[model samples]
Target: STSSPSSSSTSVETPVETLKSYLSELLNNHNAKRALHGVSDLVWDEEVYQYAKSFADAYSCPADGMLSHSDGSYGENLAAGFSSAASVVDAWYEEIQYYNFNNPGFSMATGHFTQLVWASTDKLGCAYKDCNTIYGRYVVCNYSPPGNVIGHFAANV
Candidate 1:
């Protein structure tokens, strides 16, 4: 392996864009779909759907954007990619914090991850939380087994 670790900023930006562009494309199809089974497509609520859509739109990118899609089944490949990229970025954020705090006079860290967590599920349409750090920062992450493991290890390491 190359001794020099890849810069997280380079990796993080693409996912943010991929997610934003994908969502922006999906939202273009404005017809509301039923929130529940057998509820009838006729019962689709425009206000509710648009509200969720707008929430996704206005929310910050990369960090919180991935959380919004946490609940859904994101197929295999895409989910894997998301998990890997997030792990890398989260680790980078923490490392920067440690380096900055320890090397106070010589080092300064800028660029903060936004504080917004949104996890949607069958029971919960969109659960929102904040991933903020008093001394550092956090990205809102969907709590899944292997995926979450990557996050936990990154933080701990």
Candidate 2:
């Protein structure tokens, strides 16, 4: 068997490339949903990104396959076992099924979708990790001016 150097290099991607892929897909998915509601596109924030990365790095996937939330500083949506950015976002956006536009209030089931499209929550920072657990990878997306506020969901989401 013969192996070419080019083939080996091509098979391995750099961290920058990986990060680019994750972040671009994150923006694309989030902005597409936000556009439907006339909300502004989100811009990446270093602080938020670091927050997410730190959380992802320190996260200990619990036995129940349950994910945890961040300090109430930023609106956060999390998913474990999802690999690609699209899949992570998709898992969260899937919460839309339980959303009630008529009631227009916060529901634990729909919190992810509402946070994804929150009109005033313009900043975005996300991180994804391939971890050592049955859950596989984890994703953390932080939104500034966090969404899902009890009284404000009607207008913001």
Candidate 3:
């Protein structure tokens, strides 16, 4: 007639309680606190979330007046489909420059930059000067160019 320990009631942790517990543990640990020194508070702030949402809505892909294809494509080809790969590379360079000027702090990985160069070379059947120029810029930046220029280049290429 006695209830076993397995039958005892248990409390489910709410989201807030779980987050508080995690934060408490993180705060108590010196290493975790040090690692999260600058961003700990922003992690849970509602205002930060709102600001991020606003920025995303404002600047995300499919910018104002841009069309989207039924198949989910952006419907705007960076360089015309029939254009040669060299032309594409040139377009990408100009695009990257524009992005760098517009956005203060963004960078692209060297691996990706090299991949784009190789892809352009493959498509063009020869290496182009744009490849060396873009790659050199990437090297000068230690393989990460400021701004989302690389992203723009990749998309266009």
Candidate 4:
């Protein structure tokens, strides 16, 4: 397998076109699901994109093939193994099955879905790496006014 990893979606690192492509792809998939659930659509933010890019770049895929998260103030959703941007979003959204609207709270299995469709989270930015490591590839999305706060998932998600 190839080990020449590549990255994009930042002003300094890639073309504006690359940024726009992912911005459209990630937003379209995310908003479509959020809309179906009665939440406002999310807008792309460059700063948030940078946040995701930083994490994707700094950590990358390791030999152990495990994923790690950057525990910052923002909310994040991490995914891997998928080859397309939309597929990544779908995988995150697929967690909706585990979310209990009746109970409405944080859950390890459902956090990604909740974060994806979280109502108050209006801004989003995502980045990924074509890592040739054991893990291959991974996607990272950072949300502003992050969701999944304890006791608030009932209202926010």
lDDT of 2 by residue, 14-92 (tens): 3997778878899898888788888899998999999988987777655466787877599999887776777888888
Instruction: Report the number of the highest-lDDT candidate.
Output: 4
TM-score of 3: 0.19
TM-score of 1: 0.20
TM-score of each: 0.20, 0.84, 0.19, 0.85
lDDT of 1 by residue, 15-58 (tens): 55665544333222111221211221121234333444344334
Per-residue accuracy of model 3 over 24-136 as CA lDDT, tens digit each: 33223312222332212112334322432233233213213232212211111121221243333434333333333343333432222232322212111111111111121
Clashes of 1: 0
- Could you tell me how far off, in angstroms, the CA of residue 113 lies in candidate 4 after the best superposition? 0.4
Residue 71 in model 1: lDDT: 39
> What stretches of model 1 exceed 4 Å from their correct place?
1-39, 63-65, 68-157
Q: What ranges in model 3 sit over 4 Å off?
A: 1-78, 101-157
Please identify which of the two predictions, 1 or 3, would achieve the higher TM-score against the true structure. Answer: 1
CA lDDT scores, all candidates in order: 0.26, 0.81, 0.26, 0.82
**Location of the lowest summed lDDT over 10 successive residues in candidate 4:** 3-12
